[model samples]
Structure formats: C-alpha cells, structure tokens
Target: MNAQYKSCIEAVYRCIEACNVCYHACLKEEHMSNMSKCIELDRECAEICTLALHSMQRSSTFAIQILSLCAEICDACGTECKSHNHQHCQDCAQACFRCAEECRKLIS
Candidate 1:
C-alpha cells in the first residue's frame, strides 16, 4: 500500500485500540450506572473503528463510505467522552478526535 494509505490504516487501527481500551475502562468504573450512554457509545465506536480499519486495510471499494461513517462516529464519541472528567475518557476523546481528522483526510 502507499504511504498515505498505510498512515490512514494505522490511524484507524490506533483508534480501534483506543476505543476498545476506553470501553473496558468505562465498564470497570464504579459509577457505571451513570455511564450507560458513554458505555454504549464506547462499544459502538470501538466496533465502527474496527470495521473502518478492516475496510481501509483491505482497500475495499466502499472504504471511503466506511471511513466517512467512522469519522462521524468518532466525532460523536469524542464529544461524548469529553463530557466526562475521567482521565481515560479524556484520553479516548483525544484519540477519537485525531482519528476523525485522519479519516476526514482520507475522504478528500
């Protein structure tokens, strides 16, 4: 793959890993009862990131569309994560924002 494509794939993979970590971390929080929305978004974002990674890695014909949706999800996830005060959530939000930017680049 070209360097640019490789970089995008790497970004997607990193986002996937970050989302997975954040999801598990959120699940373990004692205040889980109040974090239902975050938990749900985390899981959904993780799944979308994984799918986006795979689609980009394979250079699927629909990769652009997938990445677009991933970008949207990442944006939403980042916004949601940033609303929390937890360190993990903050980190995840940053990662998600970065991922969204990377995905947007791919779109253009």
Candidate 2:
C-alpha cells in the first residue's frame, strides 16, 4: 500500500489488461499458427502478473521472489509479442516491458 508499490501494481495491472487484449487479438489473427506461442505466453504472463499483484497487496514475505518471476514472464511475453508486426502486439510488448521494469525496481 506504499507509494513504492504503487508503480509496480499499476504496471502489473496494465500488463494484465494488455496481455488479455493481445491474447484475443492473436487468436483472431489469420496467421494463427504463428501466434500460438505468443498467445500462450500472454496468458502465462497475465497470470503471473495477477499473482504478483495479489502477493504484494498482502505484503507477503515471498512477494519479492514472486515479482522476480513476474518480471521474467513479462520479459518473455514482451519478446514473444514483439516478434509479430501487429500494433496490438507492439503495444502489449511495451506494456510488458514497463511492468518488468517496475517489478525489478521493487525487487532491487
């Protein structure tokens, strides 16, 4: 609930929304085969972000490690999304990057 957590929580929530949007967008793409991995990672990243947010909210002792995992998942999702040329993918990648950075800050 501190200001230090505000940025990370906001970034995580934003990433969750972005990942959901990107996952749906990938599903609708005609190049479904190419987007399969991206969609999977998007779901995973969103789930991790949610877990990290809840852990932080509860001020859990394991929050730092959870955030670290969140950061790794965000990085992976961002990389996967960025491989595609779609605007949604690009936006999602950016959101993931922001979330990763914020999460790392909390850990450090």
So what's the TM-score on candidate 2? 0.96
**What lDDT would each prediction earn against the true structure?**
0.85, 0.94
Report the poorest 10 consecutive residues by lDDT, candidate 1: 1-10
TM-score (all chains, Cα) for each model: 0.92, 0.96
Q: Give the alpha carbon lDDT tens digit for every residue of 19-102 in model 2.
A: 999999999999889999999999999999999989888888899999999999999999998989999999999999999999
lDDT of 1 by residue, 3-98 (tens): 567777777777777778888888999998877787888888889888888786777889889989999999999999999898888888988899
Model 2 steric clash pairs: none
Candidate 1: segments with Cα more than 4 A from true spot: none
RMSD of each: 1.2, 0.8
Instruction: State the displacement of the C-alpha of residue 9, model 2, in Å, after optimal TM-score superposition.
Output: 0.4
